[model samples]
Target: MDLHEYSRYDAVGLRALIVAGEVTAAEVESAARRALDRVNPEVNGLASPVFETALGHAGAGPFGGVPFLLKDSGPMAEGVEFFAGSRSLRGVRARHDHDLTRRFRAAGLAVLGLTTAPELGLSYATEPARTGPTRNPWDLARGVGGSSGGAAALVAAGAVPMAHANDSAGSVRIPASCCGLVGLKPSRGRTPTGPDSGDPAFGALAEFALTRTVRDAAHLLDAVQGPGVGDKYTAPPPPRPYADELGIGPGRLRVAVTVRAWSGVAVDPEVAEVTLKTAELLAELGHDVTEASPALDWEDVVHGTEAAEAAIAAPFLTAPGRPDPARLEAVSRALLAEAAELSALDLVAMLDAQNRVSRVVGAFFTGYDLLVTPTLGELPPPHGTLSSGEEGHTLRGWLEKLFAHGPFTVVFNLAGQPALSLPLGHSVGGVPIGVQFAAPYGREDVLIRVAAQLEEAVPWRDRIPPCFASKP
Candidate 1:
C-alpha cells in the first residue's frame, strides 16, 4: 500500500483489507508513516512521533492493525510523552496505560504518536507555545479548532483515517467542524477515564475520537463505549451495536434548530445561513424542524464551564513539581492563579449551577428528539486569533473569547448530552462548515442514525484538503 491508496480508506475499510489479507498490517503501517511524514510538516499536527515503537505494536480485534494517533493529552498510553501542549510538563510520560488506551489497543489500533493541543487543553485554538500552531488542513492560514485540533488536522489531511480526541468544552466537535470530519462527543460516562482519574471535570468531559466518516465513528464507539473499572457512573448500554444504528432509519422526529448562540455571540452570517439550510434540509427529509432554542442562563453556563476547566487544570498546576511560571502560557498562568483562589464553596456553587442548566436543557430535550445548531459560531479563524500565549487575559475573558468562536458546543458538555458534528456545509471560501446534532444523554444511537442520514444526503467524501497526504 502506498500513501495514495492508503489515504483512500477509512479505518473500517483499512481493517477490511487487513482482515482479508489484501494488504499486510506492516504495509499499512508503513504507508501511514509515509502519510504522516508527508503532511505533518505542513500542518504541524504531530507533537511526538513514536513511529518505531508503534511499528512494533501487534494486536487482534475489530480494528486490528489500523493506524491511529493519540492526542497529546489523556487517556494516556504507557511510555508515550503527554505534555497536554504545556511547556512545563514537556518531558512527562505516562507510567501506565489509561483504561481507554488499553481498550484502543484491544480494538487493534496501532498507536502512531501524540497530536498537539493547547497548553493544558485550555484554548479553543491549538496554538501552544510548547508546540506552536496546528494549522488547519483546509486552509493553512486558518486555525484548527482545539484542543483536538491536531487529531482533526491529521485525519483531514489523510495522515490517518481517524485519531484519538476528547471533549470537555467542544474540543472534539469544534475541530471536526473546522476540519470537515465526523466528531462525536459521547454521553458522559459512556467511555472511561479511569484508574488515574474519575469523572474529570465533574462528568463534563467525554473521551472519543475524530473520524473521516460517520460509520467509522459508530464502529469505534462500539469498540470502546463501556465504562472502566471504578468509573463514577456508566451510560445505559445501547439496544444494539452502534454500527447497527447506522442502517436503522431515524423515524420521523421533532428537531429544534437554532442559529443563535446561548451566550449571545454574533454568529457568522455564513455559519447561520448554513445552519438554516440544514434545518430546511431536515424539514425536506420529513422531520418537523422548528426554529427554537432552550432558555439558558448564560451566567450560570459560563460559571459552570469555568469551574470545570479550572478543575481540569488544577492537578497539573498544583502538582508537587508544579509548572514553572515562566514555562506556562499566559492563559495557563492566569488559570493557575484562578485555580489557587478557587474555594470549595465556589466549586459547589458552580456545580449547582451546572446541575440547574442541565435540568433546563434536559427539559427542552423532553419536547424535542434532537437539537440542531451550527457546530461553531464562526468559520475557522486565522492562527494567533486565540493564542494561549497572548498576554493579559483573565480566565473569564479567555473563556468569553472561546465561547464567541465556538458557542454552540460547550453547552452540551455541561448538559452531558451526546452531540455530533457533520461536515454538511461549507463557506463560499471553501472552508468546511459543520452542523451539529445533539441528542439526549445516552442517545448517541439516535445521533448516529440521523448523522448517517445526513452523511448520505450531503456526501463529503470527495472534499479533500489542500494539505492532504495523498496530494502529489
Candidate 2:
C-alpha cells in the first residue's frame, strides 16, 4: 500500500486489510518505514530504530504486521535498549519483557523502534539531552508534551496508527493534547507493570496509548488491560470490552467542569475559553455540566507528589553502576540530591498524605460521574521555555514552574483515577487544545462512552498535522 493509504487507517483498519488479504504485513511495514523516513528527520520523534526486529514479528498477533513504536522510558520490550531519554543509561537493555510489552507482542504489534522522552521521564518536554527534542507535528517550534511526546508525534505525523505510551502526571494526556490525538490513562493497576517494577511512583503512574481515534484507544486497552503475575494491585474488570462502549450513548449524567487549576495557577484565556466551549458542547448533548472544581488541600498534594517521586527516584540514584554525574542533567542531579536528603519516615508521611488526598478527591467524585478540565493550562509552549538547565532555580523552584504550566492533569495521577484527554478544540493561534475528562477509579468505560459522544459531536480525526505522512 502507498503511504497515504497506510496512514489513513487506524490499527484495526490496517489489521482488517491484512486479514482480508487485501495487503501484506510486509507492504504495511514498508509504508510505515517510508513514513518514518519521510517525517522522522523533521519531527525528531524516533530515538532508535529496530526495523529488522519489527520485520521478524510481522504476522505474530491480532495486529501482526502493523508497525508500532514503544516509548523509550518504560513499557519495555525484552532486549530493547531502554535509555529513558538519559545518556547515563544509554546502552541499558531490558533483560526481560515487562508484562505489558509481552502482551503487545502477543497481540501482534510489530515493534518498530523506541521513541524519544524527556530525561528520566521527569520533564514535560521531550527535549532529551541525549536525543534532542521531539518536535510537535502540529508546529515544529512548539513542544510536544512528554515523556510520551515521541509516541504522540509519530502517530500524529502518521508514522504509526497508535503507539505505546504511559502516563504519570499527564505524560500521555499532555502530548495527546499538544498533538491532537486521543490519550487515555487507564485506572491504576488497569495495566500491569510487573516482574521489573510494580506501582511505580506510589500508584501515581498508569500505562496506555495515544491514538488518532477513540476506538483505537479502546481496542488497544482490550489488548493490554488486566493484572500480571505477582502484581501488587488489580483494577476491577469491566463488564464488557471497552471498545463496545464506543458509539453508545453515555446516558444523562452529571459532569463537573472547571477551568480553575486545582493549585490556583492562572490558566491562559484561550485555554479557558476552549474548556468552557467544551462544557457547553457537553451540555448541548444533554449531560448536566456545571462549573465546579474538586476541593483539596493543594499544598499537601504538591508535597505528596514530590515526596512520592523522590522515593521512586532514590533507587535509581543509588543503583549499582549508576550513570556518571556528567551524563546527568542539572534537574536530574538536583532531584537526586533532594531524594538523598529524605528519610524513610518522610517518604511514609508523604504516602499518608497522598492517601488522605485520594480519599478527599474520591469523595468529591461521589457527587458527579465525571470531572472535566483543560489538559494543560497553556497552549504548547515553545521549546526551551521550560529548560531544566536554566540557572538560579532550585529543583523545587523548577518543579513549581513546570507545574504552573501543566497544573490541571497531575492531580488525577495522584488520585489514581482514569483520565482521558480529547482533542476537542484548537487555540486561536491554531494549536490543538485538549479537554480532559476524568472518572472515578475503574470507570474508563464511562470516560470512553462520553469521549465517543464528544468525538461524534466535535470530530477531530480529520484535523491532520502539517507534518503528517498522508500529505501526499
Which candidate wins on lDDT?
A: 1
The C-alpha stretches of model 1 lying farther than 4 A from their native spots are: 55-58
lDDT of candidates 1 onward, in order: 0.91, 0.86
Candidate 2, 352-395: lDDT as tens digits: 87887889889989999999999999999999988865546565
- Cα TM-score of candidate 2: 0.97
**Candidate 2 local distance difference test against the native:** 0.86
Report the lDDT tens digits of candidate 1 across residue range 1-472.
8888999999999999999999999899999999999999999999876557582344678999999999988889887767888888766778889988988998999998989998888988999987889999889999999999999999999999999999999999999999999999999989998888776988889999999999999999999998999999799999999999999999998999999998888999999999999899999998999988889999989999988988887787656666788889899999889888989998899999899889999999999999999999999999888877878989899989889889889888998999999998889998999999999889999999999999899899889999999898
- Lowest-scoring 10 consecutive residues by lDDT in candidate 2? 49-58
